[model samples]
Target: MVKPANKPQRLSLSSLKADFSSAVSRRRLVYLLCTFFVIYALCYQWQFLVSLGLGPDNIHHMTVGLIPAVGAVVLSLALYWRHLCIASVVPTALIAVSWIVTGPYLSYITLIQQNTVYLNNMYDIYVGLYLFAILFCLNMAARQFLNRKISAAIMTAVQFAAFFIIALQWVYFALYHSCITTSGALLIFQTGPAETLEYFHSLGVGRIVFIALFVALLIGGLLFANYTQKTLPRTPVYRKILPLLSLLIIFPSVGALGEEIFPQAFPIRTFIDTHDYMERSALYAENHDGKFAALQAVQLNPSESPNTVVVVIGESETRTLMHAFNPNHVENTPWLTSMKEDSDFTLFSNAYSCVWYTVPVLERALTEANFYNNKEFNSSISILDMAKKAGYKTYWFSNQGSIGVADTPITLVAKTADVSEWVDQELKQSTMDGALLQFLQRVDPNEKNFVVLHLMGSHIEYRNRYPKEFQVFNDGTVNQQADFDNTVLYTDWVLSQIFEYAKENLNLDAMIYFSDHGSDPDKGRQPDDISFKVLRIPMFCYLSEGYQARNPEVVEAVKQNKDKFFTNDLAYEFVCGILNMQSPNYDPTYSIASLQWKMERKDLVTRFGKVSLLEDTEF
Candidate 1:
């Protein structure tokens, strides 16, 4: 093809306006906006409903959720109302503003604002999208395969079903705080096979009648709307362009099929994925329940003097980063270094986190669970269960979030405790760790209590982990290192507060502080890096004056184990030894303070999938 070589045309505002007006009439714009808005709502329905049940931020959630439905109804009316020379702006304004405000860019913004991580990031709010895709796809498919009469029938059925579901969901949410899930289904079934209907009836026959009546009204309203939408007389030119819109909608779901890849840009797929997760989660919950119930009871012997044990679990911290433990003189750990020389505090020289992740490591550390006998450990009962049975109050205070309670395995452990309080609502980095202290100060401290404080220490996105006022080494180092040191410094301050309270105010026994896992400080080290620093964690015991005066043997154990090679897999047994609380599961060899305790080749588990073969690591 030969170029005509015409001079390039300069764009102008008037020409642009004319092109836009010719391409998209007000009626077509309304239809397009309404179409896409419906799709967006479908993707976010689950997230929106969840936020509604959350403590705060429901107003924003409500706005995002309702706009699409209002747009849909208005657009449906506009279809027939236009024939009667009624105002189209009623629908157009609502649909147009909603579409642009909650468009793709807005979806990304909403996702970030929601502070969703992992699976949730894949599912949370995106500007109105999922519903539109389904509608547009249905219309285009109908246009190709069926006549206008059949197409109308198909659309009405879909719209009615969708409307009915939405109505039903509202009532269901009112009755129960949550949506249908596998755990809920199992719990319902566990009540009794025949009690499902009786349970519904128990809500009162009046409530049932009201729900039925409401559903009937919604169905009638949907039918009326569908009739008007179908009977609209004029054929619009935008109908030709709708096929093109349908292709664009379909493109996200199947566009990568040509390259043999399936991406997650489609909204409807998130809903499907959520449904699948619900089913799987429900099955697992049911199976786990049976095993848990069948397990032998947790047994513990209460000592002559009831002990008040406190466990502080830190995050993403390594001994190599702490000034108290590391060769380098890092001022980030000033408190720990100052406290190290105190006879009441015992700093363990050789300690390693058992696993790389928070939940996995804590599961075994707090309970008896391990990779080897997971079924038995998960079912056997936790230290919290035993603590309660032994007549001690157990409390779980966390700086982390309580979202995804079912999927978060640590939540199951938390439930075994007498009291569980999560200070952080969102999973964002800005939530301070000091909030855990508020819960601690308010709780009854005089009683025989076992409290666990989970902190967000030195986790990723290091810059967001600390405030500017607390920053120390920012001007002349890699920013990641400065941010990391800032977190550790903040952690040092936070830990000192807990210690002061325990020693000065509470009837404290001993407090043990350790990390869940260690991370490479420079940032972004590969998971496969077999470095000693990544697994090595700083652990110390702060024994109150009363505790030391009562149990002299625990002090001796701490002294003897100061140099022992400690892996956190033995943490539960060690806790048992520290508190002198004996259980049948407790092994003398697993306790570092015990003479029989010894490190073997099989004891060391590394991130690179190695065991029992560390070359140069020593405590």
Candidate 2:
């Protein structure tokens, strides 16, 4: 087709790409990018600062966000005035050292409190430096593409908006992580417009005013960041060093990549995963819905006076590290060790945790589920169901978390009981397990009951597990073994208290105590790992005089099978054998207490796979 000469030529839209190069220089871009990270880190982590300042003792205080953010700001300011670098290397050195101590390296104190090896302190500094370098490089690289004044203003505005939202989210979570959790989210999730407005109304005018001011401060900070940039001279060495910094970034980029691939380790991703667990928990709830009621309909006969069963579930405990089990010369668990000598106590020397993770392990352990076949895990009748059907008042009092994690499979099973009570509704490690004892004292002793006490036993960041008084083992050293021992001691105390409470107040007959899984004290950074320590848990049964008279044979058999290999996944059946409850799901073959029990020969099972504790192979 012939085109008219008067007609304009068509412009290709594909060729159009906005350029901000004239406004933003490589150095200025680097400065701005660096500022963005520093500011965001500050806003997100300011809540943690209150903790770092409080020292190692008050470790529950969140400080990671605040320390690094402040450090970055100092560094950014130092680099801003080119003269600050030219003035003297000494001041720069001082400033750099300050950051290493208080910023990313603040993990130093945190690791010390965890009782980790001294090597972890060096590793902490290296990680902190690497992180600082990564952010430093990023700020520089973004500025490499420059733009005009208007373009720069537009870019700054965009960055400000993005950071503002992020700042708000961090601020909200600062308050949230301190207390708010899945239940609160679910409450907000289920609330309608009227309810939402009522929630705001409940915050009241004074609180509302404070919230408004808090928001305003965040906006003001953004403006201040822009001002800081304007004060700096554009003349810079950023472009020349960009390649070196970028090359340095490659090492830390692996962290970014890992965060992308395994986001659960990252904060935002962790929040999402925690929330996702709730969603999965909801599905778990749905799958098991009405199944408990169905189990009750089965018309199972209860043994005469089943008495009381207190299934005390422990967390992150290693039997090998325990004095009652191995001692390792750390008498951290003196009371438990003493209790083990009592004739009433029957210890399961070879008890293995069903899995490493909390939710997965609890689901399998409590339900009629096996490691290989998990179908019935979500659908089958639980021990709580068996308890309820047998005409006993079932109560679940968990130190872990009660309300927010209702959808979690473990919580779901807890809810299956007649009454589920959580001592720590916030679900943060901030609360000590001793609070569980208070809830125990409240349970009605007159009723025929079954209670499950989910303890936060020696989970990591060991210092937080106990109060100041429990710091009996090497209180002044960065000895993780000591800290771990103290936690075990603390756990020993907690278990003792529960046992005493059961004996004193409630209709105490038989008590079964076991851990969900063990933890590698040396490696966990908020407690995550799997090894022999992660699987081996101290499980034991304590029978009162009346129970021994009624079921002497079962008690005797339990003692005999202490050396036999067994996974805690079969704990429900074991309890059934002790209680003498009959149900389709109750297999005497799996219970160590039952004479018909068949030992899980050779391999000890776990949530991931099986490992023989006897063999010197990798767990």
Highest lDDT scorer: 2
TM-score of each: 0.61, 0.69
User: Where is model 1 poorest over a 10-residue stretch in terms of lDDT?
Assistant: 115-124
Lowest summed lDDT window (length 10), candidate 2 = 115-124
Clashes of 2: 22
Candidate 2 Cα errors over 4 Å, as ranges:
1-184, 201-270, 296-306, 372-376, 402-407, 426-430, 520-530, 613-619
How many Å off is the CA of 312 in candidate 2? Answer: 0.6
Model 1 RMSD, rounded to 1 decimal: 10.3
Q: What TM-score, to 2 decimals, does candidate 2 have? A: 0.69
State the lDDT of candidate 2 residue by residue for 305-366, as single tens digits. 53567999888788887877785557777877888789888877777876676766777778
